[model samples]
Target: MSTRPRRPRPPHPLRDRRSPWWRSAALAGALSVAVTAVSAPPAQAQLDDATRRITEAVSADRLRVHLQAFDEIATDHDGNRAAGTSGYRASVDHMVGALREAGYEPRLQTFRVPYFEVVAPATVATVADDGARTRLPSREVAAVEHSVSGEVTGRLQAVDTDGSPGDSTSGCETGDFEGFAPGSVALVQQGECSSGRKAANAEAAGASAVLVFGSGEWRHDRPARGSLEEPGAVTVPVIGLSYQAGVELLDAEEVSVTAETVSELRETYNVIADTGTGDPANTIVVGAHLDSVPEGAGINDNGSGSAAVLVIAEALADTEVENTVRFAWWGAEEIGLLGSDHYVSDLAGNDPAGLEDTAMYLNFDMMGSPNYGRFVYDGDGSGFGDHDSYDAPVGSGAIEEAFHEYFDSVGLASGETGFDGESDYVAFIEAGIPSGGLYTGDDHTMTGRDARRFDGRAGEPYDPCFHRACDDITNIEFQGLEEMSDAAAAVVLRYATSGDGVDLAPPVTGPGGDGPLMALLGVLAVGTVGLATLLMVRRRRRGPAG
Candidate 1:
């Protein structure tokens, strides 16, 4: 709903192909007016029936029950449900029980994820030429994830920083450190690359340590905590500073930094269950991150999403469908998208055929922000450009149109959010799977346009309790939750029942059927005809030569 203008991106690599699902003609006709009455098409009628039934069954009251249970679990165990914690394990157990109650044989997929925590407060101080030392506020300095525990003192050198809004490439490239002196503390801005790359570059240039500061639209009042990407990526200590704190050190001649931390690998599990009613070859994965940040109960942050998926799964347990629905509650999404990443990677490596059969993935995260705005993923790359690195797979646009159609049918206005690679859907999109999802809002401030559409406060974060200890059940907006969850359920059931607008070529099992093998046979048939025609032309020319 922000309507923030996005920069133009490179063209998507995936070729656009029409699918039986939302074809251009069908989509144009559907969106031309309100679809209050079901369309005459059988497929559209089936979709409408499924959407209404599922939406009616999975109400906000049911969602609240699950959220309450998650909150109680968090309360019993250390006030948080972060992965690698007892609270998260209990959360998983609770979900497993619910799945079984809903007639599902849920399985736990185990994986190890990197974990980092601050053992003590970090200190960063700047020294002026007159030898006066001034310590930056403790709240404004935080240790970057995976930073080595150590202390260092040296000259503070700003690396290619111009202090301009949304424009900085500090310490991203080796050339940025070309004229840097040895043993200096590299001062870099956060943007354009990973924090790990900046720290590694600084260490390679012989800097004793690094200080990464918040920039651009990021809040400058508090420390900008970020990860160094991986453990042992650099030997030197890396610290994060607020923008105000960093500006104070820009003119300083020297600085000192100290940090203490713990870093290790922790075990976690992803909950997966398959509804055995539909075809196994065309699986639709509906997922949400089950783990929360280390700071809070995370009721609204993810409990809203997780609960919606659970309720929808229960509501659709008895419904017959043509495509399989695989429900996933991803783990370790806070640190990174480790759970979903591992699932996709393992499938691609161990079951390439299965991965190919996957029709699409739908992700739901943070659905009930207090200042919520209905946001659909920019699958068409119109509102936000295609992702900077990976291309959105073909057929994603059709999925986007489906959500819009449902919203329009209900007379609810919606807006677009870019595929920013910040959620679990990142793994699916990266794998070139058709992906789309719904989100209310998170952390980012709502624009005037968003306020007009959703009637929430303007110029305020969508979720003020984001990643904080205050993100309890009370932080959720049930009205928005109900609307968003209904939209999610409607779209999900539509995709599960029909493959229209999706490229779902049947698996290669026989010589007949529209599959890779059949396409290959068609090509061979064309080639043989062309060869015969060429030979006849040669024979005719040979008579003249004789």
Candidate 2:
């Protein structure tokens, strides 16, 4: 990855915030729940100052920079910011600029990903039974860049590749895929295997061509003529098929599919900026990905997350937080967790010495959406009182506790969910860094049950228009956006100013990760049994009988 100099863009036209608004009965209900929790007790006095600073950190003007950048990159952006694209480089430049304006300087971290484009005349099921061919559209049927290539005309072999591990060989572990031999087209299922590995295995078995089915939905979904850059190299044209189509080819003899990769050396950049505030060692990182998909402006997919972080950074810029804060706008998150992966891998692999001082990683992904659910991945599950609805991560104790405090204080009927490999948080989690953050639900369908569970609209997708062009500014719910913003702001504030939340001293290095339990330990030691002695002493002193 390369770093880009910040490029200034003209200001975006302002939008009106006081426009007339209408609220639905459902939203009214949700808002009632949101407001109900406001009477909760305040955070400990030790945290008041920090919370005030963080609350003030995320400002409306700061949010504007994010909205502008999101609009520019998603709508007016040159193209998809895949790992090695120029559009990606421009996005990075913008990130670096925003971070500098906010007050923390981040270093450039880079790593490589196989960038596969297109090349060759692609044919899908062109020669099937009785030479009856059903050709598909060019764009719909293409190969992933990392797969082996070859030409063969023989009986098409079908394998049930369901439940197999991604990049694992167990599904193909048995025979030499007997029915799917060299000179034949092998058809495999999608789940349990990665596109890259499935293609690689077929190519290795001397199979001339490969067609992977869409796990279950469609038999022969499409010929997998896209990027097939698997671990080990085997050059074979691979195709993806719908589950139905792959089944149709089971008995077909002498079938052929051809695909190729258009290799290009493109450039993608990571942006770096500095608050020039505190030391780099005791750092606070707040981040969101900056790229959009090729289809529509990914406003909600990430614009929500990106926008919130931007606002938070601006709010905290001139303020003083104990530890320095760094904000990163990662690129190429959709394809894989590319940007953050590159940054961390390069650090741990190349310079392990620098890892000790890095304190915390905070992520903000989908914060703004018409229908959103506020969730925190319990980093350590320590403070998860009897509320069984939430699940926390093993080490996210400090962060998770802070979020719960915010939620409890706000009286939001919040729940915790397990961590899935769907965002940039993975990079930090894998590195054992204490990480935690908030995310509104995505892509998952929202049902009436969800509505009753979470105080929001029922019978719709959490983000009805997730990952599509329809994910524009108008798609989000203002109430949900405000709640998320406030909650995150609170956590950021608490972490920045005081307490172990921002304390970079590794738990082990200081008093052991046992600080939170100390007060409880003291209570159990004397509070429970000391009351009787105190009462007796008071009665004796008062000479009650006399």
TM-score of each: 0.70, 0.69
- The collision pairs in model 1 are 20-500, 20-501, 21-500, 21-501, 22-501
lDDT of 1 at 523: 35
Instruction: Estimate candidate 1's RMSD in Å.
Output: 13.4
Alpha-carbon local distance difference test for all models: 0.78, 0.56
lDDT of 2 by residue, 1-546 (tens): 111111111111211111011011112222332322223122222134555456555554455456656566655554344456655665566666766655666556565555655456556654755677766555445565554344455667665544232322423443637565667677776654466666666767776777765544332445433345432355666666555555555666667676665454344544444344565666666777766665556666676777787677767677666666667777777767787787778779877755655577788777776676666765554324234323333447557556655554434545454455567778887777778887777766655544654566776667776677676666666567666776787776655665443553322211454432332343244443333332222222221110
Q: Per-residue alpha-carbon lDDT of model 1 for 413-459, expressed as tens digits?
A: 67767777788888888889988888888777877767777788989
TM-score of 1: 0.70
The deviation in Å at residue 265 for candidate 2 is 6.8
Query: What's the C-alpha lDDT at position 274 in model 2?
Result: 38
Model 1 residue 11 lDDT? 22
